[model samples]
Target chain A: MSFKVSEDVAVCGGRLLKLSHFSQVIGTIMNVNVYLPKQYYSQTDNKVIPAVYYLSGLTCSPQNASEKAFWPFQADKYGFAVVFPDTSPRGGDVPGDPEGSWDFGVGAGFYVNATQKPYDKHYQMYDYIHKELPTSLDEYFSNGSRLDFVDNVAITGHSMGGFGALAGFLKNYDANRYKSCSAFAPIVNPIKVPWGRKAFGGYLGADEEAWKGYDPSELVKKVSNRGNDRILIHQGTKDPFLESNLKPELLLEASKGTSWEGKIDLKLVDGFDHSYYFVSSFVPEHAAFHAKNLGLI
Target chain B: MSFKVSEDVAVCGGRLLKLSHFSQVIGTIMNVNVYLPKQYYSQTDNKVIPAVYYLSGLTCSPQNASEKAFWPFQADKYGFAVVFPDTSPRGGDVPGDPEGSWDFGVGAGFYVNATQKPYDKHYQMYDYIHKELPTSLDEYFSNGSRLDFVDNVAITGHSMGGFGALAGFLKNYDANRYKSCSAFAPIVNPIKVPWGRKAFGGYLGADEEAWKGYDPSELVKKVSNRGNDRILIHQGTKDPFLESNLKPELLLEASKGTSWEGKIDLKLVDGFDHSYYFVSSFVPEHAAFHAKNLGLI
Candidate 1:
């Protein structure tokens, strides 16, 4: 479970440490990029730095968000670190989309523990991201360090990863795992979407109940929002996938009359797309939100 | 002289309009990205917005800097439009590096008007960037528009384009074309380096006199610095090509006893490299500097 340092690049007022480590849950090597803010290096006092975990969308690696998201500057501003986890487990031996499509294969793991044949062995990204990777990172960096990668943390993502963030936040809402949650053009209701249907059908083996455990719309009704927590969401109107793949309105509809009613702050931005340009434009706002929740404000 | 609007992406508080037009000088289609600040769309009065032209380094298109430089936010912050010009004229018939190398080929035009065979036909980047592009863009957008792409503008670049900016700024010093000049890890004294030697020899023939016209070190002594103008430059200490290809000290040495002596602010930052990460880190400072020079402050 020891992490291996691959490349350390200096960005903004921080350093982006590209790391790879062995994952016991997936039984494969995983790549992750962590941006340690300037405070971590120029620490004069022992202050625990909170972390914001950013899960990327489909067909994205750690480098995509690390390079384009412009998160390092905000992390430096707020005295927090940003952790970018890879989208999917990748290798030559891994089974990809049968039709050689981009949406269902190597780059698109959908962040789920596959219970099906051929994919069950190595496609355990659900556990890898939520449970194992954070514990391993905490253990690796716990050498008299005060960087909290586990407890005092927040979660955010884009598109499918946005679905992951909402699902993870809702599933662990009872335990109060994540301090905050936000998403940019997220696939909120995945079970009813085409991309989610294929991924769920392939990974979870056609079980509707199994799919509910990973769907944010279903999780909202199961978990109670006691803190009156506000989950921020920004969906671009010009996003090409809004009508077909990401029906965010379903998520708001699902939370109706529940404990989480009126708690989801969904902001429909004007003239923006489903690209990183849209994600990065609102990153400062999300950073401020996360910083406030993480007690750095 | 007409521009074709290919892709208009909304980034930050502005619109990144990707345009392509036939260059009369280079005799080829060239791609350029223009980021019109929010002020342009929300104009309530006759406010003339200035432009900043950013040239890319070797093996770069307009997209590289457009995607990674994080200039849109700064452009919006300072109320300035940013023009990202292509490194060189590119096509299937256009000749590339003889060795099929990256640093001396199509992407590595070095922004010089070549006088050599084959390359001379399409390698008129110096004129295309400094003359044709600005004029065409100005004419194209002159329909009840307040965007100034010609007179009140600044120039900045990275690596080879750094040399281009310094050369262009100094060459047009008497005309007062650009209001400000800056570079990030630029090739200061290309005449004394291998990259410069190869490009000069191939494009300008073996005439050292012709090479001097395009060299920043040589231009500093020839052109007079009027208004106590300062050329801001940031060189990374950890940049792999600092000593060999980019001899920024040589430019300083050549500027000794000249009008530009003690005027070039060459800052050697620690532990940085020749990447967009390095450039984007210092863009805010450069943006503020240009804002002051362009009277935006």
Candidate 2:
């Protein structure tokens, strides 16, 4: 699929390219933002630049993280590109939550391949984000450029997007699709959370086994983590969703006897919330972690 | 007389306290956001933390710069507090532009004390920002603290607010009110520009003499500069308003042959715009400049 350049605004030593492309997987026009670090423009070396895909929380577009997450500075600091993918396929015809609640409808795709009726027509976001989008971007930018959008990439997200990152990373762990993975106040065990249950029930036709494939708590048990691989996670204590929506402790408990035990670096920060303020506050640490894993440091 | 706390958000190594207070100067409850850096909470030393007052441009509230400017990191890095003040007094009863244009109404006070009818009753932003707001904050945080909101302070802003900073800095030059002054895409020669002419005509009632009092280009000639005092400025060459609304060159030209000659550090950044992305891109440099002037360096 071809891409259209909507806006290329200069931000923090580089440019933030806002692009909209026709996604073959989702059968809709998907919006995504890519920040190319200053190194890309000033590069004398012929090295392929790795990418970090950031999935946003509920009620978010690619613009939220692109504007507030402050990732451009971090991307410029260590030579890597950042990709901000939209939460879901949004249009008038696209089926949303019938109740008009923010948690269930559009902007809350939960990053899953839908099997349910009307949603299945345009809600193939899991394939759109993790597979089709990256391949298309690689093809779009492959004009004598060595920007690797497929391999040597890191993944991170906030809340629902955080759940997406973990599930995607673990599902592709054997193939080593993502070199590094991190989350900011993510819903680690989506299978046990209300947000996950509703989304899974709506999109996957209430199939509990289908839900397990996208749940990090369940996926961690099935996917064997190779030796010395760590997944970084930060959870805010003051986050209102900690008790009912995002019980991060469940993921740790599920990983107790597995190879993923002690490999998940879950840091509980004090007095922070589930906002972009929290996501940006710790982006430097996450960037450095990804930089190390991507061989940039 | 008393401040009301609305939302206290944790951001970057600090907390953003969103406050509203009834102001005698403006005759309304004014909104302000103050960012108390991490050092404010974790201080063992009795060091007086300096403050930086950031004035927003037209049609912006306290939230615009607070969210997009990315100043919290630099404030924490250099141990200073940042204050974001609303552009103008806004309410339904308060008078706005009869034409309902965004340029000269509600959000466009131009940081001047209004003398005209229908606006003078509530649009005293000049006194509200520079004098009353600081005094109120100092009184609010005067419990065994060393946060200096009055004396050891820096001033900076973008576009309209940039002009405000320059005008305020120059008007109080003899008193040495601010330790440092900087701007991003400011309208320097307000007397000659259309936006300034309209604002001045509306706020000051057709008095060109009164307009010169707030014009930085005119103030440069009237106010004798002290030795070794420099004003730092960054203007985006690609700013859409550079030709019509913001003629930064006139300020430098007005400073020629005066005591302020060669003291203005005006940098024309390449490919930048009149957006917060441009402001944040250069915040590190401005922060360092202010930090040095505030004696933090």
Candidate 3:
């Protein structure tokens, strides 16, 4: 579980460490970027920095959010580290969409453990991201206990990765895996969307029942949110895929009459599109939300 | 003199207007991005917002700085609009480097008005940027005098664009064209550097004397700085082009015994490279400097 430091860049008041490590779950080399905020390097304070994992949208490597999400400044402001993991396994022999489409394969891992052929080999991202990657990072950075990866963490993402954050948070809701959760233009109901249907049909096969295990809308009905715990979400009104692929209202509708009712903060911001421009504008608010939940405030 | 709005993107309490217009000086269509800060749209405030022009480095369209510089937040904070102009005239029959190099052609206009063959047809960036572009923008947005693109403005850039900012600011020092001037790892002595020599030779021809007209190092000796004016600069020690092409020390040496002596704030930051990562890291400091000079503090 040793990680190779490919590049350590100084950004804002901290360092963004580009790391690559071998994941036994996926049997491949995965890349991830972690931002160690200014507080982590403070010589006077021996505080353990909590991490906020940020998952990127489709067609994004760890670099997209690291470069444009404007997270480093917020992380420094809130005294928390940020972890940016790749969307999917890349490089040789890793199969992509059979038709050469960009929406699937390669950059579209969908963050699910594949149960189908060809993809089942390396598309074990559900395990790689949630189960193995965090533990591995916790073990690697255990030198001085200056950074915490396992406990006292928050999760957030954009678009496809946003859906992944919601599903993952809901699946591990009872265990309280994440202290806070938020999404930017996320596909809340994956089973009902075209992008989600295609990714799920390919990775989880024809069994729609199996797809429910990873769908946020379905999981919202089964999972109960602890009292006073709220999930914050921001959706752009001008997003092209709002009606067709990202029906965020479905998640709220599914939570009605359940223990999670009225706990989802769905903010429909006007005039914003589904670009990093939209993701970054709302990042400051999300950072503050996560910071408060993580007890940094 | 008319600019067509291509995309109006909502970001950080304002809008990023992607505009294209025909340039009478360059004899071609050009692209520029302008961010109108939140104060511009405020109903209660009638303040005429000042503009800060951010010239981009080599191989960059106006989009590079608009997307990555993290300037919107700072602009909103200081109530200043940001103007991002293209490096050169692009598309159509406009010529690039004869050898197809990225550093000289297309994106590398060096912000000069070419006096040589072929390039003279379209490489009129000096006139376009420092003169025509600003006047045209001022005219285009003169509805209620909400934004002051001219008269009250500052200038700053990175790498080749950094050189452009310094040269432009110095050449027009007597007129006080730009109220404040700053740069991020700019080529200070273009006549003495490889990138500068190649660009000057291609644009201005064999007469080395003509190059001095656009060289900041030479201009610093000729131009007298106003009593209280100072130029801010931040250079990364780890920039790959620091030694070979970006000799920032040359400008300091040239300023010795001149009116500009001890007025150029040259900050050498350690461990930063020549990417947007480096540029964005120091943007807040530069923003504050320009904000103070522009009287927005």
List residue ranges in candidate 1 displaced over 4 A.
Answer: none
If both were scored by lDDT, which would come out higher, candidate 1 or candidate 3?
A: 3
Candidate 1 versus truth, CA RMSD in Å, comes to 0.9
Stretches of candidate 2 off by over 4 Å are: none
Candidate 2, residue B152: the lDDT equals 97
Model 2 chain A lowest lDDT segment of ten: A39-48
What DockQ do the predictions score, one after another?
0.84, 0.83, 0.86
- Which TM-score does chain B of candidate 1 obtain? 0.99
Q: Write the per-residue lDDT of candidate 1 for residues A66-121, one digit (tens) a residue.
A: 88889988999999999999988888578899989988868788889999988898
Candidate 3 clash figure, as a count: 0
For candidate 1, what is the lDDT?
Answer: 0.91
Say which docking band candidate 1 falls in.
high
Candidate 2 local lDDT, A99-182, one digit each (tens): 899998699999999999978999998898889988998999989876889999999999999999999899889998999999
lDDT of 2 by residue, B141-176 (tens): 988887899999999999999999999999998999
Model 1, first chain, TM-score of 0.98
Sort by lDDT, best first. 3, 2, 1
Between prediction 1 and prediction 3, which has the larger DockQ?
Answer: 3
